[model samples]
Target: MESLIKKLSKSHKDCPECPSPKVVHSFFESILGLLFPDFATELLKEEDQISEKIEELRHKLSRILIRNKHLHDGDGAEIAHLFFLKLENVYDLLIQDVQAMYDGDPAAKSLTEIIRCYPGFYAVAAYRIAHLLHSLGVNLIPRMITEYAHSKTGVDIHPAAKIGERFCIDHGTGVVIGETTEIGNCVKIYQGVTLGALSIEKADADKKRHPTIEDYVVIYAGATILGGDTIIGHHSIIGGNVWLTKSVPAKSKIYYQAKMYNPASDETDTYIIKSEG
Candidate 1:
């Protein structure tokens, strides 16, 4: 009986195909070494000269930040150190995403595929890097990183946004998540989805400036959810190409339809309201 139990409890050891876990750490170190060469070299002895080039770029950036007053009450050396530390956290978050993508999606057959082919991964990676700079008060650099991701993936996620675990962004293109947006765990968002602010010109910077999405919500492609006060209830489904600004009830469905109108005749034709709920 004991032998049978042991056999039952034994785990299968499969072939390791992807290096998603290690890649993020190594890439983070590489990016950091490229960003602050002297510091990276000093910290990591017997390093490549790539660290030196990083230091050169950092020196130029420090001067620019000082000139532009982007940093407050911190010296160039201190800012650089803080930025690196923040980036380290961001790198950890990115690794979490890599793990999530690897474990959750069957299509992610390998770590290499995830790193090279997944736009969602790239967008999240850029956001992680940018968020570090944002927290470090390196205003311009964070935006630049996020913007680069946006340009490449068509996914514009601001660095200041707070996102929870098991979040999946599918087909990532044309997805925009604003700075103040708060996303909960196990949320899935598709391409062309926008969690944006209704009042881009509003004066409420401290107040909520974007939508709050709860857990287990699925936002379909081309769905635009706007407003600071908008709250998407848990387990809700937002249909594709729908425009929404108001709060949605839990376990609800939403959609949109258009009808042709003639100004001269003052008549409407083929009015349609498409919805499952």
Candidate 2:
């Protein structure tokens, strides 16, 4: 083992700390097993088997990061290992998403269905994992994970966002939840939605760039709510494709103008009209 470590150290001249990730991950798993004795058996039934799986996953992640230029020579593997050590949080996040899936929809037949079928769960799970890495201060890997999920699920959640529990997203395609955004519990968003910044210009850097969404708000498909200081009040329902830049009262329902196509002629145009209700 010593000779093998020396060989690897020589081979990875730029990253001397590569081997630390495995050790760090192992320590983390062991500590978790120690803390939760009730679930220890299930968590570590075949210790060798689970360790092998973790090592396999770590290698895959490391290779991907290295190949993609996400991991660098000077980047300490210990930093990443520390992040992986908090795997329990990842499990907790999964439970939250699964429970939300089971309770949020009657159509969800089983936990297996929630795990297998829901794109929302997938996105949220990715986000939770990414958020953990982000919190641990591993720069590129978290973004890479979330970006991978974005590509697969069409839900683009920035890893830097602070998300609370019981969050459920439905049909979550084309969703852009921005960095610096904070989402409270029981928030639901649909496809083609953007909870993003009002400005990306240099003047807006220190300012509020994205909206703060309170609890129980449902942002329907195709809505674009922007600005950092903008708050969508608790229990508000934002209509689809609506462009919002200001705060709304709790329980407020904002309806957006719908587009009508003229099939008669080649010329195309659109208009916006407020609702009477």
Among all candidates shown, the one with the greatest lDDT: 2
- Residue 126 shift from truth in candidate 2, angstroms: 1.3
Write candidate 2's Cα lDDT for 130-226 as tens digits: 7876786666666766777787789999989988878888877788999989899888788898989978898877666899999988888898999
Clash totals, every prediction: 3, 2
Pairs clashing in candidate 2?
A: 210-228, 222-241
Tens-digit lDDT track of model 1 for 1-277:
9987776656322312222324334444446444334314445444565456456555654554555453445575667666654655665666666677777678788866776678898788777766765776665556666776787799999989989876778789989999899998778898999999888675677778799999888999999999988998888889898888888878878776667788898986653435453
Best TM-score goes to which candidate? 2
Which whole-number lDDT from 0 to 100 does residue 130 have in model 1? 65
lDDT agreement with native, every candidate: 0.72, 0.73
TM-scores of all models?
0.69, 0.70
